[model samples]
Every structure is written in C-alpha cells, then in structure tokens.
Target chain A: MIARLLMSLTAVLIVASVLWRDPAAPVAQPHPRFVKLDKHGNPLSPWQGPWSCVLDTTQQLVWEVKTDSENIHDGYWTYSWYLSGDPRTSDRARGEANLGDCYFETSRCDTQDLINRTRQAALCGLTQWRLPSAQELSSLVQAPARPGHAHIAQDFFPHMKHGDYWSADHSQPLSGHYRRFKQGALAVNFHTGKQYSLPYRNAAFVLLVADLPSEHHSSRTSGVTHQPTTGN
Target chain B: MRKATFVFLHMLTIVLVICSLFTGLRFSLLTQDWLKFLSALLPQGNLYFWHIGSASLLSALAAGYLLLSLWRPYRSSPSHYHLWVNRFGYLIILGLLSSGWLLWLGRFVAIAQPLHFYSLWLLLIYLLMHGWAYFIQHGKYVLSALLPKQPDKHSIAAVISVTAGGLLLYSAAQHSAETLTVASLAPEEFIEIDGLGDESHWQRAPVYTIETHGGINFDDGRSTIQVQALANSQESYFLVRWTDSSMSTNHLPLLKTQAGWKIQQNGFYEFDERTFYEDKLAVMLSHSCEVGADNTAQLGNRPLDGKPPNWHGKGFHASMDGKIRDLWHWKAVRTNDMYLADDNFFGPPAIAQQGQRRYTAGYQPDGKESGAYVMNWQWYKPGLVTPKRLPDQSNAHLSVLPWFGSTPYTAENDDFAPGSTLSSILYRSNRFEGDRADVRARGTWDNGVWTLELVRKHYTGSEHDVPLTNGTCMWFSAFDHAQVGHTRHMRPAILRYPL
Candidate 1:
C-alpha cells in the first residue's frame, strides 16, 4: 500500500512539473543544409565570400542568385510567360511575347528571352540555366517559423522580392493531348506561400535552376558542387 | 440538510471563483508583463464574456447563500479557529464581488480595476488558510467530509434555480450599457476639412479618449487618442487628436549612392520598417463589438493553416468568419495632400495574385477610379534602383513628386550629386475617386500633437462602407512612423446616433 501511494505521488509531481515548464525554452532546431558558391561556382563558407548561387544539399540542385545590378539577372526585372517555339515541347500554348519589362537589349522581355540571355552569359560557369519546376522551386521555401519576411532564405537569395515567381509547370492535360492545354502557367507567391495558375500574358519574376551531373554529385548530406577552373 | 447545502454552495463558489480568476488575470496580463508566466496556464482568446458570465453566477450564488443564512442561521462551529477563518474568506469574497461588479458596470473603473486585481491575491491567501484549518481538524478524511452525499430533491432544485437565474441575468446585461453616444449637433457654419478642430460647434460634441498601448516609437509604447463625432442630417464628421513627438513625413526617400540610388529603409526587408515610413492612423468599423478585433486577430507565427507565417511572430488579422469590417487608412505622406482617407476592408482571405509583393491576408483596398499614386521607381532593390522619373527643376526634396512636373529618368540627365535624397512618392493624380475616396480627411501637426478632421456621408451606398447608423462599433489605432505596427486598444467605443 505504501509503495502504491509513493508511485501515485511521484506520477502527480511529474505531470505538474511538465506543465510548469517554460514555453520559451529553446529546443534544438534543424540547421539549413546549403552550400554557397561564388561567381565561378566555387564552394565557400556560410559566413565568407560573395556568392552568386546556392546548392541545396538535400535536393542536390544548383539554384541561381538574383542581383541588384543592372544585368540580365537583375531581381527587379519582370517577365511574361512566353516561349517562342513548338507547342508540343512546352506542354502548353505558345505564351505571349514582349509583354514583360527587363534590362535586356532585346525588346522581348518574356521567359524565353531571359533563358537565352542567361545561357549565352553562362552564369555561375554553367549554360543550363532554366526556369525551375514548381516542386523544385518550392523546395527553397524555408520552414514557416523561420525569421525574415519573404518565405525563402534571405542569406542565400539576396535582393529577394515579396512578389510571385514563375515556375516551369503549366496547366497541362493529363493525357498526351497538347492542344487542349493552352490556358496558363503556374506561379508561386512567396509572400503568402501560395500557388496559382496565371494567364499566359501575366508578368512575374523568375529564378533559374540547373541539374548537377551524375559524376559531379557530392555526398548526400553535404552536396557542395565545385566547377572546373576552365570556363564553360 | 444543512451539511448538504453547505457542501453544494462551497463547491459552486470554488468553480465560479476559479473561472473568474483565470479570465480576469488573462486580461490583466496585457499590460502587466510581470504576470506573463500565468499566461500559459490561463485560458486564451475572448475572455471578456467568460469573465463577465462567471461574475454574474458568483453574484447569484453569494446572494442565495445570504438569504438562506438569514432564514435559518448556521449552528456555531465546533472550533473557534475555523469560524474566524470562514469569516476572513467571506471578507475577501465581499471585496472581490463589490470591485468586480463596479468594473463590469463601468463605474469608478480607475479605483475598481486595481481593487479587483489585488483582491484575487487576498482570495488565494484565504483559500490557503481555510483549507489548512479544515485539514488540521478533520485529519485524513477532510475530502470525504466536504463531499455532499445523497442531497434531498429540494436542495437539488434550489441549485438548478440559482444557476438558471445567473445565466438569465448575464444574457440581459450583454444587451445594455457600454455604448458611446455620438450626439447630433447642428454646425453654425460649414465645417472645413482642415486639420484644425477649433470650430465652435466641435466644442458641443462629446469627447471619448481611449488609452491604447503596445507599438514602437510611442511614449512607453502607449498613447491616448481623443475622438469626437458630430452628425448633421446628411454627413457625419469626426475630430481625432493624439500626441506624437516628431512629425514623421519622410517616407521611403531614395538616396543617391555612387553605385546608384537605393531606397532608404531600416527593416523593410523584414516588413517591420520602423524608420523612414509615414505617420498614419487607421479606424475600423464593425457590426459586432467583440474585443481583440472581433476575434479576427489570430496570434502566433503560423496561426492560419495553409498560409505563410507572418514576418513578425506577433500575429495576423484575418476575418475568418466572413464578416466584413470597414477600415479607413490615412497616411501623412500618401494621402494627406489628397485630403482623403484610403478606404479598405477586411473580408475573407484573398486569392493570391501574380506580381503582387505583399499578401495582406483579409485586408484589401476598395476599388478606386483610374488616377492614383505609384512608387517612383522602375524597380526597387535594397542595393541599387533606377528611378522612373527625375525632377524637372531644382525642387527635388518634396515628399511627393507630381508626375506632370517630372521628366523620365535617363542616364545623361541623372545630374544629382551623390548622397542626395529624392522623394519616392510619385503622384499621378490629385486624389482618389469612386468608393476608395469615401472619407475626406486632413491632419495638421503642431506642438507635439496631431489634430485630424474627417467627414463622410451618412450612407456611402457602397458595399465596402458601413453605414453611420446606431450601434456601429468603431476602433482607432495610431502609427508613429512605423509600417504595419500600430498601437491598439482592447475595448471598442461603440457609436450611438441620437434618436
């Protein structure tokens, strides 16, 4: 009987103690697994060197870093959803062209114009820059509780606007019918963490991404990809 | 029968007292940061009605006990010590009940608020003393002695009747009192829209001043706003005045750097820009008079599901229940020159749109006519930005630059010296039209105080506006040069049109 009484008292004290614990206590939070890369795509420390790109170790993808300078990668420039080519390859209707505003020499400021300029410039010593897929782009959104106004990581992506960004995904039909899927493309609003399909002529911001080759794939835990010294 | 009555009454008192204490302390914690630890343990969200309801029940219980004791006085307690303990508990309860009732009735609140707060501590001491005295006398079976066993049917009926009476009284009190009456006054002359409240007829209108707290750049994060409303047959006029140390009119001015022009800001990256923002005031009108923004303010970072967390961990304001609340936003730099308040509303969460920078949840502006103001930048970057327009002449330091007086920006014409600042607000038109220009307002800052005058039609006929009718609940907030950070008050000052 005495043993049972002692157990009951201990159980009550434990419950009370747990209830009284301070909610503000700092529990261990998972650190972001990212590798910063310089202009020529060289790995650098989290606190050192001017970086032009970020490598998400978890997703094993190379993402472009927008800038404030008057260049093709200027963050303020906006582009409409347009690609002048065959409709079958795009999985949707050929979007309207020359409807966006940019710092490029060509009057056409559509998504295809940005892609051509980025490839010719070979930013981050790679020529494979393209608009990211919806799932791939959304992976960059930091956990909801993280600090900063924009949903993405501010340290990796500087000059980040609170506007919607265009994704490569479009409102395509489920079957192989390409003609029926001519409505619009998908865009992600980082301000509210929401996705919506915008019309083909609607202007939005863009962020490019590239795939790492199989030979260049680093360890899964810390996949930091360093480019060769020779320019691409 | 006596034992059963005593047990039932004591048990009822315990439950009502606990409910009142928790709900009351939660409200007191708003300004009393020292009692913050008690917040995690107390009930959250809309505690005002619960506090009032429990007080009504407690009052009914106390009155019932008094009548019963008068009819048949209690036998003398076996112990003299227990008798004195019971008397001390009664004294503490009396203090709590009297102060609480005075606060609920909104009479002598200055003294009653503190009296009611301190009485809870005395109640805690009384509970400890009473429990200890009973435990010493009754030994191990103190619990069994207090528990009522097989109470007669008459006693049960009495308990039910007393509870029903308390609930009925609470429902009646909810409908009456706590309304601020806006008297109808005939102005001797035309009321000018100037920011001066010095009209002779303004003196006849009654003034309601509320002390709002918790915002940056205020006097200890607190400021008292004085509001007076007057209505002719056609239009309703309002005069609001508040104290602000500095006249913050320097909005996000662009500073020319050697690299280029960069928008001047401190925390705009985090959407909590305190410096270089405009001084503003906001007024919200809602049909329901519930506290905490009609329970629309959801606290915590990620309060709403499937929605991004707020930049600041404080909270977000979204009308989840689909009720529309009209908001009038007046900015010193953006709208002061136009002599109009930007009409806005809080409705259901908006569908996210492309190219939109900020997703303001349920807060959105009412539809406007063609002409409006826009930021004077081709694109905004924290590091550098290219201006959309340049000053036509030498006057480049104005807070708002007119579109007709400026030339389009060109590299060759960019002759401004480095470190020079330019205004960012580019006015396309004089003022807003349509439903967005419903309220005509003007404000003047003099000697550390702002006097603002506003006037609108009695019924705007727009779906976005709430008609100036009787019992229209209104709330006022002030921003001292901070964006999205405004001082707030708990209780709304309801509007009453003179019959």
Candidate 2:
C-alpha cells in the first residue's frame, strides 16, 4: 500500500512537470510608412500605384524607381565610374567615360553623364537627382526572407537590378600619396546586402535619390485614387 | 539485499517513465494538431534521443524483473486488492512498451499511437490507486524502507547490465531498418525523363509506397507517394507519383486591377502562401536515416542559438553537424517547363546576415551554370506592384512568362487592360546548364494525380551531391500548393543495389 501511494504521487508529479511549459510570447508587427510619387511629383494612391519614385516618409528621402525600357533609367543598364571634375585632381583629370553599356544618344554611359542627364531631365519634378550616399542606399534594403533573393522592397522599387548599385561615397587614400593608392567608389550589393569598393573604371548599376523638402512632404499628397491600406 | 533491490528497481522505473513520457508527448504534437499548442512550452531539439534511450532501458528492467520473479517464487502473500493492482500495473506497462516499439519502428502507427497514449493514462491511474492504498496501510514510517543503508552489489550490477543492453538494442535497431531495393534495368530497356511512368521498364520495376501526413490542403492532411527506381551502368532513374485533388500551377500571378497590378496571394506576407502557390515535390538523400529529417528539423521558436526564428514556427532544416544532404526539388510552375529539378543541398547553418528578414538555414541551391528564372515584378507589395515586363499581347495570362515573349516594362508601353492577369514567374533562359541542372526531371498532372519522372548520374562527383548507390537513405515530401508546408513521413526508404 505504501509503495503504491508513493508511485501515485510520483506519477502525478511527472505528469504535472510535462504540462508546465510557458507559452511563447507574441511578436510585434509594425505598419510600413511609405508613400508613392509619380513623375510629376504627385503622391499616388497605394492601391492605384504605378509610381515613378517612392517617398520614404520615415527617412525624408525620395528614391528613384528603375525601369526595364532600355533607357538611361533602365534597371539593366550599367555605367562606368566617371565624375566631370575629380575632387582630388580638380579639373585636371576626367575619369573614364563611354566604357559602360547603356541606351543613350552617344551610348557613352558613365556616372557623370547619367548624373548630368538626370538633372537636366528633372525626373519626378525634382532636379536634385544624384547618387545616394552609402548609408542612404543601404537604408533602402529590406533583407529577403530567403537567401539569394534581392534585398530591396520589390513592392515600392520594382525593376531594380539584382547586382551592385554605385553610391556617392568615394574611397579616400589612407596614406601620404593620393595617387599611389587606387581610387574607387563605394557600392552596395543588393543580393548579399554587403558594401564593396570598386575601381573608378568598373561599371555598375545606379539609382538616383533626392532629399524631400519639409514643405512638399505633406501638401503634395492630394491624388489618392484608392483607399489607403497596409499590406506586406 | 531484497529491500535494496526493490528500492532500486522502483527508482529506476520512475526515472525512465518521467523521461519517456515527456519526450513522447513532444513527438506526439507533430502529428496531433489538437495538441500542437502545447509544443510552445516543450523543449524541441533531438527529442528522439531521450525517448528511445529511456524506453530501451525500461524494457530491459521489465525483462530482468520478470526473470527474477520466475526464478524464485515469493512465499509471502498480499491482499486481493493489492495483488490485482500490481497485476494491472504490469499489464499497462507491457502494453505501453510494445506500443512504443511499434511506433518507433513505423509499423501500424495508426493503432499504436492511440494505444500508447491510453496506456499511459491507465498506468498513471494504477499508480494512484496502488500508492494510495500502500500509504494508507503502511503510514508515515514506510518511506524509511526505501532508503537502504547501501545499494546492494547485485543492484549495481543489474543497473550496469541494463544500460549496456539498452544501448546495444538501440544500435541494432538503427542499422537494421527496412531497405527499399533499386532494381537494375536490362541492356535493351530505355527510360525517359518526360514526367510519364508508362515505360515498360517502369512497369516491371517494383514500387515502394509511403503514406505521408501533416500537410495542409490535403484530404485529412495526408498523402501517399509511390516511388519506383531503376538503374543502369551509369545513370539512375526514378518515377514518383502522388494524388492531389486539384492541379495548382498558378504561382503568385499578377493581376492588373483598376488601381494597379497586385499579386494574387493569401498569405505571402507571413511567408506561408497557401493560395496562388504551385504544387511541389522534394526528394532528399542522406547517409543517415535518423527520424525527423535526419535530425535536421529543429523545432521551437529559437531552436538554434543566436539564429533568427522562422516565420511559421514550424521549424528549420539545417545540418549543423557539418554533413551535406542532397535535395532534389521539383516545382509545378517554376521548374516544370525547364524540365529539371532544382538540385539543392542541406548544409551547415549559414552565418546570419545583416538586414535579412528571412534566413533560410542550411537550405541552398547548387551552383547553376547559366539559365534561371526570376520573379516578374520588381518589388512585392501586397496591395500593388509594378511589373518588370509586360506581355507582348494584351490580356494574356500565362503561368510563366518567357523573356523573349514579353517586352520591357514602360508606362508608355503599358497596354494591359484592367482585370488582366500575368504570370509572376519570368524565365531568364530556356533551361539550366551547370550542376544545378543535374537532375533532369518533369512532372505531369492528370485528373487528380501527379506523375513525376527524374533521371540523374550515378556519380557526378559534386561535393554537394550524394551518390546514387547502395545504402543511401531517401525521404520524399509533397507540397500541395503550399509554401513551407509539406507532407512528411517517418522512417526513410534506404536504397539497396544489386550485387
């Protein structure tokens, strides 16, 4: 009888222990705060969006949306690193041009030519289009759930190249002689979310960005063609 | 000495029951959806180790106790009530042990699972009744008898022998599992990887069928896969067929609405897309036949330390032990037209990257030579999207868009009318050229079934691929238009080759 009582007590304790697990805590999911803008710099409805540029309200930046139309803004186009006037050498040295493959009048697609063309065209009703800083470009990356997938949010920035996009950050010389070390610019690889410094002659893709002024941020959002809703 | 022996046996039984009961419940949650909520609290990595180890020890202890009782009959007698309770307790334990072994061996699981669970409840009840009576009769002083001055030498010997015997049994069971034989093809026989099992050679080959369970969008969440393997001197071919009520080929198609283009998906945000997904089949090969995907499936919110948790909480498949397992994946929409199975492998956990929202642990595709497919849209927003390409013709709905068949997307060139649909998958090339295209495969869907045929080299010598040789264990899983949800089965079908 005593042995049986002990066994019963032990069994109850064992069963209780197995059932005494703590529930997993719920994770918090926040809503995205992005607004889409058209070529005329007008905010488009989230549902009716085929926007030319994306305005990231949180970051106060307007991002260029690439296309696949074989034009200067085509996502598949690549450009060589060239600045009209070098910062270190001033006007003495013009970097390599006409080394990249792109659809342009002269077909001489370089970083300087692209920057000049974008400003002249005043894309998205803004002439401040230029290469984004390394930090700014990386901030646009939303890591994919799976490996080997692209890093940007496809919903907002469609037609983006899966390869590297050049940043405005140039790698400075660490030692005494600036000419001794190879000059390069920083680029962000969207596939792996890693930053790389490429030689000035190496061709890469580009996406222009501009700062959104405080006055134009809220007042220009007039034409919302559809109801606003949050989605993945 | 007698008192010490009794105490030792009782203590051993208690410990074994505690270990096996908890681990068994953990495993039961995998198939028993009703109890799935309890899994959140249970520890979930390599649970089979503890369950099997304790079960083996318990069986050995029971056998030893029975033998000793038969060897020397006890002269003393007990009350009728006490005797009946002891007999009933032993019966319940016996039922539990037998059912447990049947379940582990993957035999008659439909019957064994419930029987084992009921026997556990019975054992608990028996213990309560028996213990209550003992305590009532013996009073408080009866506890002192359990702590003998010292454990007897015989008791120590029994413990060592029991442990050794249990380990031996476990090792033997691991090696001697049933093997599925791969029949040889004659010189004149021919086979094609055209997603058809109508070849005469396939008709002559033996078929191995496995009943799978626990996948969404299936009848009662179950499916059965029938597999046939044939080999020649240099190549091996496999024909796999499974039943699915509907043929789902539309994989996240883009719909052009009055507002904009939106992807047709039900749960893409959570990474668990059940609607607008394609049916898929995956075949994995490994040297070890350990259950639960060779122990690669680590369950729980955070199974691996310092790793990002999976979105579904189902778990992740990663070979943390540095061994590679070959995987062949066939998709209805993605790889069906390519006539190839995306050759992939399970390797060690990948290093966590910065800004990665979803981290696919260990699951990686093999190196591809050239051709591949990419999603049609530039970015994905559940509400609206801008497509990467527009169909040359308006209102054309295709399961996959060929690169040459479509024009680059442009606002001026946008001719798709509202309410038109386009395939989300875009082909970069006709087919793959390198190691990623090693497994030439094709699948066809008929009234309610899918027939898939695959052929690969016997030995490609790639570091990521396992050789199609004798003793290689294989597992098959089927996804019925679901992302990250697949039908699973226990006990791998090990390969055997002709001498």
Query: Of the candidates shown, which would achieve the greatest TM-score relative to the real structure?
Result: 2
Cα TM-score of candidate 2: 0.71
Candidate 1 lDDT over B1-499, as tens digits, reads: 2767777777888889889887777666544547655545666544556776887788888888888788875565556776887888888888888987665554555566567778888887887678755655555577786676788775686588679878887766554435666767665557899999888878877888776655568766556688998888888899999878889998989999898898998767546678999999999888887654665665443446655444443445767888888889999999999999898888776643211334456777786644578777764555677787888765686889887788778889999999988888888789987788999999999988889999999799877788888888888888988887787765677888877
- Predicted complex 2: DockQ: 0.15
| A-chain TM-score, model 1 | 0.71
Give DockQ for candidates 1 onward, in order.
0.06, 0.15
lDDT per residue as tens, model 1, A49-70: 3567777777777888886545
Instruction: Please give the range of 10 consecutive residues that has the lowest summed lDDT in model 1 chain A.
Output: A223-232
Q: What is the TM-score (0 to 1) of candidate 1?
A: 0.61
**Over 4 Å off, model 2:** A1-75, A80-113, A116-232, B1-6, B31-36, B65-100, B113-149, B185-189, B243-246, B250-268, B273-276, B369-371, B375-397, B401-424, B430-433
The CAPRI-style docking tier of model 2 reads: incorrect
